[model samples]
Target: MNGVLFDSFQHNSWATKVLLKVCSQLSAEQLATTAVGSYGNIIATFNHIILSDARYLHHLSGNAPEWLLNRDLSNDFAVLEARADEAANNWQQFFTQPVDGEQLTILVSGDYEIHAGALIAQALHHSNIHREQICAILTSLGIEPPDIQPWAYAHETGRGRDLPSEQ
Candidate 1:
């Protein structure tokens, strides 16, 4: 996979973790709040994002981490953060490999097959979509949402830097 193709995965993980930390501070009641057009309440949306990311990652790489395999998934902040970090590492390794974008991922149960490239695209879009939904929930609750944008990720991770005045 090219750098840009994979780098977004890192950003997705980072941004999700960032937002998770922010949302972790909310009370259980607050976490249950929902906004119009969102996928679900804050807790549900966040959990869906984490769990579903692993689903796509698993299909993409044919390897699933313990966090993905374990059935003890919950809305616990610590568990979510741990899973997110583990997922980030896995995603990093996955990107280090050559990507066969044109390869087909067979789905016998569903009687369907999807291109790896399309799955990858869906994985990227899925996280962004859910994150926005969580942010919308926060906005509706009068809580300022964290900036989980790619620009913010770049700034935080030093992927982006201000160019000093040119000599």
Candidate 2:
């Protein structure tokens, strides 16, 4: 009841928030570092991911958060985390609706329309790809990023329990 049946939105937010916290500890130069295949530096990538999330959520629910309009909350971890929280709440609210995946929705102004399910899928997929990019950047820096996989989210949030191995 908190979100969609699988609630990937919450996992998406949690995983990104976890990555954001890890990135917060980096020095300025480190944060600004980007790999050959990444989307700009860590800060810029985080900005893109969070802002795009707001946009996708806005398209879905018709409620736009201030970040989508303002676009000035850059590289500020506190602000980013707060914005992520607001986005998570909005997604939770959206999931509560009687949504139909087959319904058509406008992706962007004047852009072609797509199935409602595709929009949601894109949002989750986008967040994931960028997070891995950051992880790659971190690996290049010799830093081990925290595990933000769905299983890690499940373990941290008690969504799953492990059993001991048996012979």
Model 2 segments more than 4 A misplaced: 1-6, 164-167
Candidate 1: clashing pairs of residues: none
Per-residue lDDT tens digits for candidate 2, residues 1-167, read 33444548879999999999999999999999999989999999998999999888788778898768777557789988998888878888788778888888886585879888888889999999999999999999999989999899998998877989897
TM-score of 1: 0.91
By summed lDDT, the worst window of 10 consecutive residues in model 2 runs over: 1-10
Stretches of candidate 1 above 4 Å error? 165-167
RMSD of 2: 1.8
